[model samples]
Target: MLTIWGRINSHNVKKVVWLGEEMGLAYDRRDVGGPFGMDEAYRTLNPNALIPTIEDDGFVLWESNSILRYLAASHGGEAFYPADAQRRASVERWMDWGFSWADAIRPIFFQLVRTEADKRDAALIERSVARAADLSAILDDVLGRQEWLSGDAFGIGDIPVAAYANTWFQLPVERPSRPNFERWYAALQDRAPFRDVVMIPLS
Candidate 1:
């Protein structure tokens, strides 16, 4: 069985685990990091002391995007990962873009979800929110022109962004509207794996 160590509420953890569900893989997901705290066993699996580390069979892997690519390429085959070089690159591009997106929006998520209401930095949040909304416009523009970031069909590319995007949409802050982005996000909400795992309330 695949053993995954991470707290379920984590954004990065959500992406990896949701992908496992998407691929119909039954995994043993454990609570680690955050309040759960990492033990020596978890550190042995991931020296980084991160929220997510996966041990599949005897192969151990860290990093959510790396795990996504590895699992998709190994198990999902041509249908999920794609065979053509350009097609695969397109899928990878969005996966890479997710890192930047995560950086931009993390403050907003942290302030709203983790920090106390009275203790939150309103100015920092305002500035950070603008940054996040501006960065998100890139997704809006691209999604407006295409059905999926993977092009035409849903693929491994959509998982990370969609997982992170749940917070963007659910957050209490106000931001400009992006019809196409909303449309794409709503479509993702219809997926069972997305609904079950990624649609969870912000923590």
Candidate 2:
């Protein structure tokens, strides 16, 4: 059995849980962040004290995206992670891109909606909106031609990006027209795993 330590509301933690569902793996999840206070045991698993550290067969892993990749490679083989070098690299790029975009926009999101309106930073919100718009345009263009980020088939690469996309769409701000991104998101919404893990109301 696998054990995951993290709050369900965390996007990164959601990615791992979503991937597990996609791979048909059942695991135990322990809440340890957000409203849940940190534990000394969790620090041993993840020194940075980040949500979403996993224990599987005595092997512990941190970094949510890396954890997803590990699960895909170890369980689903090339189907999710891919064995071909070029294909694997292509999928890997989306994961990196997801981190970059999330790091840029998450603060804005946290400040704007997660924090009370009176406490919100207006300038930061504007900047976050701009950055999110730019990021969405790039994704909109890529998704316009393909059914999934990695290719025609869904895989590990889609997990992290899609997790972030949920946040992008859920924010209480106007989004630019993104028909392609919308279409891809619609398809993802139909997936049970995505709905189960990634479609929760924003915190």
Candidate 3:
């Protein structure tokens, strides 16, 4: 059995858990980060003390997006990861974009949603909101033409972006009217895997 170490509320962890559910892969999850507290054993598995570290058949892996790619390739094969070179590259670009956007917007999200109203950094949140909106518009345009990020079929590309999108939509900030983004998000909401794993209360 595979063991996942991370708190359920974590976006990175949620991505992995969501992938497992999507692939119908049964796995055990252990809480170790956030309020759960990390120990030496957990550190051994992920030296960075990150929230999502997985042990699959004695092979430990860290990095949330990397883990998602690995699981999709190992379990769902071409369906989730894709075999076509152009399709795979297109999906890979979205995955990479997700990480970059996360780094750009996460600090603002942390300050705005995760922190108390009294402790929130208004200036930082304002800047982050603008940046996040700009970034989201780019995604909105891409999703405008297709049902999924990578052409007509859903694949690994959707996972990482959707994880962050959940956070964006859940936040109190005002969002632009992006019909395409909304349509795509609505479809994801209908999925049991996404609802069960990614659609949790924001912490």
Candidate 4:
């Protein structure tokens, strides 16, 4: 059985777990990091001590996006990862971009969800929200032309950003209406595995 070491509430971990669910792969996830605390033994598998370190039949891998790519390529075949060089590159491009966007939105998520409202930095939240909206506008424009960030169909590219979008759409901050972005997100919301895995309440 595949063993995933990470807290389920973690956004990064959600990307890997959600992909596993989407692929219908059997795996077990253990709680670590956050309230669970990290174990010294976890470091042997991942020196970084990150929440998600996957041990798959003895092949250990860290990094959430890399795990997504690996599982899709190995188990999902052309349907999930794609084999064509250009098409694969396109998926890779968005996955990179989406992860970058995750870094950009981390502060926004932490301030609103993780931090107490009275103790939160108002100025930082304001600036970050503005920047996030600008970034969302760019994504909305691209998505307006296609059905998925991974191109015509859903794939690994959409996983990273959608994990973050759960936080974005749930935050109490005022956000500009992003029709195209909302349209894509609605479709993601409809998927059974997506709702089962990625739709958890933010921690």
Candidate 5:
């Protein structure tokens, strides 16, 4: 059985948990960050003290995207992860892009969702939101041509990107008109794993 460490509300943790559910893999998840509080023992697994560390048998792993790739490859999720070199590289690129997107949008996310209203940085949030919209436009253009970020089918590439997208829409900021991106997101909403796990209220 796989053992995972992290709180469910975390976007990164939600990515892992949702992917696990998508793969139909049985696993145990232990809450370990964001008020759950990591102990000294947890440090041995991840020096960064980040949410979402996974142990598959004796193999311990951190970094949410890496864990998603590993599980997809190790399990029979090659349909999502892909076996072809070009296809796999495409998925990897989107996963990496998703991480970069998260970095760009996180400041806005923290400002609106995590911080108290009076304490929020309006200027910073405004700038970050602009940047986020610019970034989202790139996804919108790509999604306009394809059904999934990984290509024609839903796959590993969608997980990390969608995880952040979930938060972006849930935030109380004004979003641009992105019909393609909205369509893609609507499809993701129909997935059981996404609905039950990734689509939760942002904390």
Candidate 6:
């Protein structure tokens, strides 16, 4: 069985766990970040001291997006990670975009979700929210033309983007309405893996 080390509430870890669920892969996830505290042994598996480090039958791997690509290619076939060069590159493009957006929006997420109101940086939060909205608008435009980031089908591209979207939509902030983004997110709601693994209450 695959051993996944991470706290479930972590966004990065959620990407991996959700992908595993979508593929119906049996795996065990250990709590290692946040209040759980990191273990020395876990550090050896992932030098970054990150929440998610998967050991698949002793084949250890770190980095959430890398894990997503691996699991999809290994088990989910072309449906999850396309075999075609251009198609796979398309998925990779959005995966990269997701990380970029994550960096932009994380400050807002940390301010509202992780920090107490009294200690929060109001200015930074506002800036981050504005930046996030700008980035998401770009996605909204792309989504307006395509059902999924990976073109017509839901594939590896959608996993990371959707994982981040879960946090974006849940945050208690004023957000401009992006109808296309909303429609795509609604479609994700119908997936069993999304509902069960990615839609949990934010920590």
lDDT of 6 at 140: 91
True lDDT of residue 17, candidate 3: 94
What lDDT tens digits, residue by residue, belong to model 6 across residues 1-203?
A: 98899999988999999989988899999999999999889898889988789998779999989999889887899889888998899899999889988887788888898999899999998898888899889889999999999899888899888998988999988889999999999999999999888899988
> lDDT for every model?
0.89, 0.89, 0.87, 0.90, 0.91, 0.90
- Cα deviation at 102, candidate 1, in Å, is 0.7
User: What is candidate 1's lDDT per residue for 72-98, written digit by digit as tens?
Assistant: 988889878988999899899999998
The CA-based lDDT of model 3 is what? Answer: 0.87
**Candidate 3's TM-score:** 0.96
Model 6 TM-score (2 dp): 0.97
Badly placed stretches (over 4 Å) of model 1 are none
Q: How would you encode candidate 3's per-residue C-alpha lDDT over 1-203 as one tens digit per residue?
A: 98999999888899899989888898999998889999999998899988899999999999998898889888888889888888889998998899877875697778976788899888888888888888888888998878898678877899888998988888878888888998999999989999888888887
Residues 1-203 of candidate 2: C-alpha lDDT, one tens digit per residue: 99999899899999999999988898999999888979887887789989899999999999998898899989888789889999999999999899878976798769965899899888888888888888889989999888899897999888888998888888778889999999989999999999989999888
How does residue 85 of candidate 3 score in lDDT? 88
* Pairs with steric clashes in candidate 3: none
- Please report how far candidate 5 places residue 193 from its true position, in Å: 0.4
RMSD per prediction, one decimal? 0.9, 1.0, 1.2, 0.9, 0.9, 0.9
**What clash count does candidate 5 reach?**
0
Question: So what's the TM-score on candidate 4?
Answer: 0.97
- Where does candidate 3 stray beyond 4 Å? none
Which residues of candidate 4, in runs, are more than 4 Å off? none
Give the number of the best model, judged by lDDT: 5
- Assess candidate 2 and give its TM-score to the true structure: 0.97
Instruction: Give lDDT tens digits, candidate 4, residues 1-203.
Output: 98998998999899999999999899999999898988779888899978798999999999998999999988899989989999999989988888668876889999988898799998988988888898899889989999998999999989998998878898888999999999999999989878988898888
Segments in model 6 whose C-alpha atoms lie over 4 Å from true places: none
The estimated TM-scores of all candidates read: 0.97, 0.97, 0.96, 0.97, 0.97, 0.97
